[model samples]
Target chain A: MASPHANPSPRASRSNRATTVHLRLRKEIVSGHYPQGSALAEPVLAEHFHTSRAPVREALIALEREGLVSFEKTGRTRVRTIEAKDIREIMEARAALESMAAGLANRNWTAADTALIARNIDAQANVQSLAELSRLDIDLHHHVMLRSGNTRLLQLWEPLRWQYEAYLVEIFKRQAKEDYRPETDTIPSHRKLLKALSSGTPAEATQVMMEHVLFNMTWAN
Target chain B: MASPHANPSPRASRSNRATTVHLRLRKEIVSGHYPQGSALAEPVLAEHFHTSRAPVREALIALEREGLVSFEKTGRTRVRTIEAKDIREIMEARAALESMAAGLANRNWTAADTALIARNIDAQANVQSLAELSRLDIDLHHHVMLRSGNTRLLQLWEPLRWQYEAYLVEIFKRQAKEDYRPETDTIPSHRKLLKALSSGTPAEATQVMMEHVLFNMTWAN
Candidate 1:
C-alpha cells in the first residue's frame, strides 16, 4: 500500500494513478452513486478525475473484470445489474475462495491477525446501517484473504469484493422496501469465523468459514 | 468448435483469427521453439501470422494472461521462465479448483459423463510419450471441469491449462537429464478418480479428486 503522496518513477506514477482511479470508480459504483444499468461514459469520467481517458478506460476494464460494469451491445460501458442468480453464484464462489483463505490464514495465524479480525467484528457491532455493516463484512473477508499470504489466492478473491458489495446494496434496498431486517445475525457469524481461525486448526477453520459464507445463499433464498 | 473453413461474420472471423494465432504461437512456445526468456516481438509475430498487429498483440496479451509470456522491463514481451516454485504453486491451485470441479461434476454427472472420463483414462493408458501423457492428463481434468456445470469454475480452470503444459515440458526435460522415468502411475489415479465419480457421492468424489491432484505435489519430492 504505497502512500498516495509517494513520488515514484514515471511508470510507477502512471500505475498509481490507474489504481487511484480504479478505487475511486469502484467506490462510486459500490456506494450506489452509479445506478445499475447507468452508462459510465469514458469522457465524462476522465473529465471528472482530471486525468486523460487512458486511465479511465483502464479502470473501466478492471471494473468490468470485477463484475461491477459491463460493455453493452452498443459498445458503451454501464453499471451491471445484479440478478438473483448472480447473487447465488457470487455466494458460491465467495464460499469456495474464502474457505480456502481461512485454511491458509490458519496455517500462518498471528496475534495481530486475530486482533485485526476482532477489531473488524467490534466495528461491525457499532454500525447503525446495513450499508456500513456490509462494507465492514467486505473488509473482514479482505483481511482474512490478505492474511492467507497466498498471492494467487488473493488475486482470485479480489474481483469478488465489489460484486459482494453490489449484492449487499441491492439486498439492503430490497429489505428496506419490504420494511424487514435480514434474519441472519451476520455479526455473530463473523465473530465465530474469527474465533475459529484463531483457536482451531486449518481444517476446522475452513469448515466454519464455509458455513459462514453459505449463510449468504440462505439469505438469498 | 467452429471449423476453420466456416465462413462466419467478419467479427467472428477476426476472433477466429485471433484464436488461431494464439494457438499457433502457444504451440511454438510449448514445443520449445521459442526458448524460455526469448523475446516475443509483436511486429515479428504479426508478420509470422500474416495479419495486422492488432490480433497478434491481442494474442500476446492472452498468452501473458496464461502465464506463458510476460512483459519485460524493456517494455517488450518474452517467454516466461517457469520455476520450480511456479510448478508447486500451479499444482496447489490445480488441486483446489479440480477438487471443487469434481464435486460440482458429481452433482450433475450422467452416464455419458462417466463414459467420457473412462475414455480419457483409456486414452491416458495408451500414450507412448511423457508429453502425450501430460497432455491427456490436462484433458482429463479439463473434461471434469467442463462437466462441473459451473461456469465460474470452468473460467477459473482455463488459464491454468497452458501453465500445466509448460511445467510438464520442464519437468520432463529435468527427468530426462536424470535418466529417471517417474515411477508413479498417473494413469491409475485418473482411473480411480473416474471410478469414484461414477459410483460415489459428491463428497466422496471431491476427496478422491483432491487426492488425485495432490499426487502431483508428491512427485516433486
Candidate 2:
C-alpha cells in the first residue's frame, strides 16, 4: 500500500448538501418554478439556492441522470421538456417494473404488509387536499414495490419514479387549482388492485399490476 | 436570475479525471489487485493513483453505487465480497432486462445491426486471450441491448453490466491461468442467439434470451 499523502475529503457533509439541493431542485423543476427548457446555469442555481456551485453542480448532474434535465448541445443545461414519446417509454419501463414488483410482493406478503396497504387506502379516503391525495397514491405504489424485497427492482424503478412524479405533480397542481375533486375512480381502482394482490396468485397479481399501470388510470402524458 | 457570483466549476476537465480514476479503480478491483474487503482509504488510493483525493473520492462513490465497493459500518470503504444471494438477484434482473432487449432488438434490427453481431461472432471465433475473449462477450450483449433502442432499459442495465463483468472477469482470469480454453459452447450459443434474433419472431428471440441467461452456461460463483 502507498503511504497516505492526502486528507480524507468531507464526503458525508458534502453529500448531504448535494442531496438536499437535489431534492429541492427536483421539486422546483417539477413544479414549473424553473420552467421546462429554461437555462439552469450552475452559478445561477447556486445563488438561487444559497449554496456553493459544487452542490448545485452535483444536483444538476443527478437531475440530468434522472432525465428531468438535459445537457444541451451548445454547452448549456436546462430543465428537460419531456415529450410524449419519452413519457410513453418511461411508462413502459415503469409497467414492467411494477408488474414484477407485484408478483414478488404477493409471493409471501406478511399481515403487516397487507395492513400497511389497507391503511394507505384509509388515508386516501380521508384526504382532502389534492396534493396529499396524489402523494398517497404515489406512496401506495411505492409501498407495494418496497414490499417486493427485490432491492434491484426498486433501485431500477427509482429514477423513473422521480421523473414520472415530475410530470404527475404538474397535473396535480393544475387539477387542484380548478377546485376539482380528486378523481373518484382512483380509490376504487386501487382497491381492486389490492384485492388482486391479496387473494389472487402471483401471476394474477402480476397481470393486474400490468393492466393497472398500462390502462387502469391515464396520466396526462 | 441573480448575477452569477462564482465562475462555473471546471466540470468538464474535473469530470474527466473522475472518469479516468473510476475506470482504473474498477479494473484494479475487478482484477483482484485490491482484494475483496480490503480497506480502500481515500488518501492511500489518491497517493497510489498520483492524483488528488477529489478524483479518488468521486471514483469510490461511483464504485460503491455500482455494488463493486461497500461503505463499511465503521466508516471505512472496502471492496465488496458479493454474496451468492446478491449474485442470484443480479442475475435475475439481467435475465429479465436482456430478455426484453432481445425482443425489442428483433423487432427492428437493421442490416448494420445484423452485420455487427456477425462480425462480433467472427472476432469471438478468433480470440486467443481469455481477457480479450471476455471483453468480446460483454461487447456483444452491450450491442444487442443498444440495438433495443430503449434508452431507459440500457441505462438500467448499465450498472449491472459493470458489476456482472467484474465477476465474469475474475473467472476469465482464473481460467486463463489454468490454460483452460474458452468454452466451446459460447461461440455456438451466441450464434444461435444471433440467428434467433435474425430469423425468428420477437417472442421467440425473447424466450431464447431468457433461457440463455438463466441456464445454458454456468459460472463459478
Candidate 3:
C-alpha cells in the first residue's frame, strides 16, 4: 500500500514489521525509557516486539542514522548520550526551521489557525505542571508548522522533534521544580507570536519565532 | 549492521533488498528516466529488478511518502507530475534549509570545508552540459550543508534535495538551450556566497545563500 501518512512521522521503516519496531525503539530512546548509552540488544528488542531480529536490527540502524543511537567499535549499538553540544546544535537547527515555518504561517494563516492557537494559549494560561506546559508548547508550535502549509518543513521537523522534546522536558524538570508562572513565560511570548502570525508581516513572524526558539526560556516554556 | 553511511541518503529501507530496489527507483523517477505520471506496475517492476513484488511494493510505498509518487483512489501508483506549485514550494523549502546551513557553515567552517566547496565552484565554472551544471550545483550545496556541522540539518536536507534537483534540471533544460555564461550566473553568485561562507558573519552567510537560492537565476545555476 502507498503510504498515506502525511504527518511528522519518521521516514524510516516503511515495511510493516520494521516501522512498528522503529517507532517503538525511537520513542523509548527519545523519551528516556532507554537511558543514554545503554546497549540495545537486538535479541532483547526482538523478544520485546515479538518479532525476529531482522526488523529490530533495521530499526537500530535507522536510529543510529538519526543520531539517537550509535554503533560503538565494540559492535554494540547504544543510545547516544545527549550532551550539551548535541543540545546546542539540535536547538539551533530547530530555531532555523521554526523561524522559516513562522514566516510561512504568517503568509498562509487562516482564522482556523488563529482560533486554534488562541485556544491553546488559553489552555496554557491554566496549565500548572512543567510537563503539561511542554506538551502544550509542542502542540502550539506543531499547529503553526502544519498551518504553514509546507509539508517539506514538517518532514524535516519530524526527527528533530523527538530530540528537542526530550531535552525540553529534561531542561524543564531541572529548571522548574514547581508550577510555572504562566504570566511570565509562555503567555506573553506565545500571544505576541500568535498576533504576529495572524496579522503581522513575514519578517515580524520570523523574528519573533527565531527569538522564541533560539534563546528559548530556560524552563522550556 | 548499523548505518555508517550518512551523506544525505534516504532514511527508508535499512533492510537490504528493499533498500537496493528503493534506491534505483528513486534515482529513475528523480532523473525523469521514468516520465512523470508513469504508472509503476508492481509485477513489471518486480520482474525488471529480478526480485519479487514485495520489495518493489515497499519501494513504491516509500516513494509515495516522499511526494515524488502519488497513489490514486483507483489504487494505481504513478510518479506525481512536478507541477509549478510543487516546484515553488520545493524550491522555497530548499532556500530556507540551505540558508540556515550557510549561517552554520560561516560560524564553524574549517580549511577542509572551504577547500571542498572551492573545488566544487571551480568545477561549476568549467561545466558544459546543463545536466553537468545541475549535478555540480547539488554537489556544491551538499558540501555547504555538510560543512555546516549540523547532522540534523543535513538529514533534513536529504529528502528535499532529490525533489529540488529533479525540478531544477527540468527548469534548466527549458530556460537555456545553449551553454551558460558562468560569469553571468553561477560564477559570481557562488563566488560571493563562498567568500561569505568562508569569512563573513552568520547573518551575511544566510542572506547571501537565501538570495542565491530564492530569486535563483532562470537557469538551474
What lDDT score goes with residue A131 in model 1? 76
Question: How many clashes show up per model?
Answer: 0, 0, 0
Q: Interface RMSD (Å), each candidate?
A: 4.2, 4.0, 6.9
Descending-TM-score candidate ranking: 1, 2, 3
> On residues A1-221, what C-alpha lDDT tens digit does candidate 1 reach at each position?
35644553655422556668999999989878877899889899988997767668667756776778987655578999988877766676677777877988898998998888888888876777777777777888888888877665666667667777777787676677443242348777777788889999998898898888878778765
The number of the candidate with the highest TM-score is 1
All candidates in order of DockQ, best leading: 3, 1, 2
Q: For every model shown, what is its TM-score relative to the native structure?
A: 0.83, 0.79, 0.78
Tell me how each candidate scores on DockQ against the true complex. Answer: 0.21, 0.21, 0.22
Please, what is the whole-model Cα lDDT of each candidate in the order they appear? 0.75, 0.75, 0.77
User: Residues B10-40, candidate 3, lDDT per residue (tens digit)?
Assistant: 3332444567888898988887787777888
Judge candidate 2 at residue B168 and give its lDDT. 65
lDDT of 3 by residue, A73-131 (tens): 55578887776777777777778778888998898988988998999999987886867
Candidate 2 scores an iRMS of: 4.0
Local error of candidate 1 at B190, Å?
1.8
- Categorize the docking of model 1: incorrect
Question: Best-fitting candidate, measured by lDDT?
Answer: 3
